[model samples]
Target: MDKKTILTMVLAGFLGLAQAQNNSTIAEHVKSATAISKVLGDGRKVATVILEYDAPISNRSLSPDSYEVEGKEVVGIYSNRTPETAANGTDGPYVVIEVKAEVDLDARPAPPTEAEMQEKKERDRMQGGPGLRAGWSTGGSDEYPGNAVVLQKKEIRTRTGKVYRADGNPIVTTVETCPVADRFTQEEFVSPYTGQTLPYNIFLPENYDPGKKYPLVLFIHDAGVASGPVKQPLYQGNGATSWAEPEAQARHECIVVAPEYPVITVDDNWNYSHHLDTTIALLKELQSRYSIDSKRIYTTGQSMGCMSSIVLMLKEPELFAGALLVAGKWKPELMGPLDRQNIWIISCEGDSSSNTLQGEAVAIWRQQGSDVSEATWEMTQTREELSEQADKMRAEGNHLLFTHLTGGNHRATWFVAYGIEGIQDWLFEQHR
Candidate 1:
């Protein structure tokens, strides 16, 4: 008989056997077997048959892991595998062939008992797993013996060598570590061209000697801020603060030259063009007096001060090794015409003015094929989360770094941006 006729006859016989036994048969298992044989057959005198039975025969169950049919008298069974009596086996009647078949049964795990669920809920509540217990503060109390149960505690010693909490908690509140300002000799220098008396607050390193030449960071203040000769009472704004003095000088290991602009503005408007001339004069005067490293000199500023740095770069790109512009606007037309310089742009996402201007500058710089690294401060997420994303980007060959702060506004963004760990190390790594 033909292969098609043989297959039809075998299917009819299986259907008859299923009806006689009062058992439902699946036609799909037989159809799959037939399809497999047809693909494997090489024009040999072979036939494919579909069979249905309560238990699969030993030869047909070739592989427990793979789905296939083999051997003579292949009987396809769709039922749960269980040890049963087999009269023909050497292992006795209790040894039965294992068979795996699709069966309808409950596959889900049993629901927890009421008492068990209540126990778990209580355990979670004590551990502050979630929900209402999330805000439960432990404040370094010894009552919470387990380290995992303590909310937030860090080891710290006060200036007086007293053991205290570093991170803020209920028991140990955050203590401000404001340092005494280091005394430095003040000097005034006259501008050669304009004859304008310009004063610079020169901070010599703690271990300063006349023989050593030191690296310098020229910090410029924004408009209406007098920061040169007279140390004005510290007003915090534009990403800089008086607190920055001790931290920056200690960490950077450099002398800070903060120059003041007399009559900070020529007219009512804060014109960077006018202040640029004064800055140039002041830098020259400072260079004459102090043994400053020309190649290692860096410039950075906040707000209008940042604008001044950009203006200085435009006039004399070779003056400084690198520039960090924070929350400042740069004119796109002027930027395109300027020579390439090592630039690091920093701005918060909330600062609309800086974001718009800096975004434009980045695009233009990319088009010009200039080397620039941008560090952005986004206020939507925490710092740790943003650092993770920044690390991923670094892996993907992008120079942009991001510092995200939770509950950060435009004003407070710079407090974290400039104060990022190893910021100066990253900044000075490259010089052009």
Candidate 2:
């Protein structure tokens, strides 16, 4: 063959080899795209999945289109989400191209199969005994006529993790058809010493009758707030009205009596001791009218309400079963005497004042030899995590439970802490 012809043939063979290599690189890119789809079946799992291909070519070029997944019908696309060009003096036109595929998890109902049902039953059997019960009880009262008021109680189907309703009913289980009071009744009692008439809202469980005595809870609000409009002292908002009322009542089957502290700030400072005195008086009078279990009386408060709770427990430790203090500060010296009582101290990180106070109280409680459990958590801007942490704390133990929310502000933490479902659960658990 002629020299020129031989050279031409050799050049053609080299060109063909280079083209083959390019095709192999593209095939590898396709494989990577498929792997990405496998990783992101549901878009909710990840926001975006990116696949990169580095080629030897000087000019970085991406495929115009993406491969489609079969059966799943998910589409893939090349995204110039981030384009990076090579620095000067670098190889020609070389760039780094990243292709991203966005997949969203479908929101569809997943019907439980027979196997799932059997698995759930087996799981429940393995868990053994009821998970937890809410509501007040006279330590398993037998004299009280008929079945006791049972609110939130659940039989779980798993030991790992499960979501439950506010009433402690499992969401995955058969729907509970239990009946509850349509509208709670309110009763007021007047304290002659302070000339303060306190209102207590009574929640009668479904089929409630005056013939039987029921367990009771005394809820106190911070100063400057009344039970409600009209000055009905006994008509203060219980769990059923203020926030998560139904959940609170269901979890702790008791007549929650929230009394309004007089609006007067004693001596121009917040003196809760006086308000607590009136509360005790009002409670004593109610005890005479209602069959309240003196041993099971529990106290809980938020912010100023929490302050009053500490003072009340200090002043009359013998009167309460336990106390849950949220975002409130108290001197260890003042709480020293009440160390014999079960106490829970909660605070948020953002509020340095309350946080410092809470830390001091915990330290004092420890010094006094009180059994205390504390859990401090980070709070998001939305306060969702704070609520979750409070609920978890309430569920873990009813007596002496403290939950700290990280990044939470003072005001928002109080409201959320007071409204947690676990609060009532913790209160009632003391009776056990």
Instruction: Please name the candidate that would achieve the greatest lDDT relative to the true structure.
Output: 2
| RMSD of candidate 1 to true structure, Å | 31.3
Tell me the deviation in Å of residue 20 in model 2. Answer: 84
TM-score of structure candidate 1: 0.50
Model 1 bad stretches (over 4 Å)? 1-185, 224-229, 233-251, 265-270, 337-339, 371-410
* lDDT, model 2, position 216: 67
TM-score of each candidate? 0.50, 0.50
User: Against the hidden true structure, what lDDT does model 1 obtain?
Assistant: 0.44
Q: Count the backbone clashes (under 3 Å) in each candidate.
A: 0, 23
Model 2: per-residue lDDT, tens digit, 375-428? 876543233555566577665543565677767566545534544454544556
Candidate 1's residue-wise lDDT over 1-432, tens digit each? 123433343344434543433432232112111111110000111122222223233332222222222222223322212222122222111112222221111112235567746755775688557322211221211110000101112332222344322243221101111112213334566766677666655667667765776677776654434322233211222122322344455666566666555533221122443546767777776778777777777787766567778778777878887766766676765677443666656666666766776777677767877644444435443546554544443444333332333343444444444444344555554454
Candidate 1, residue 323: Cα displacement in angstroms equals 1.1
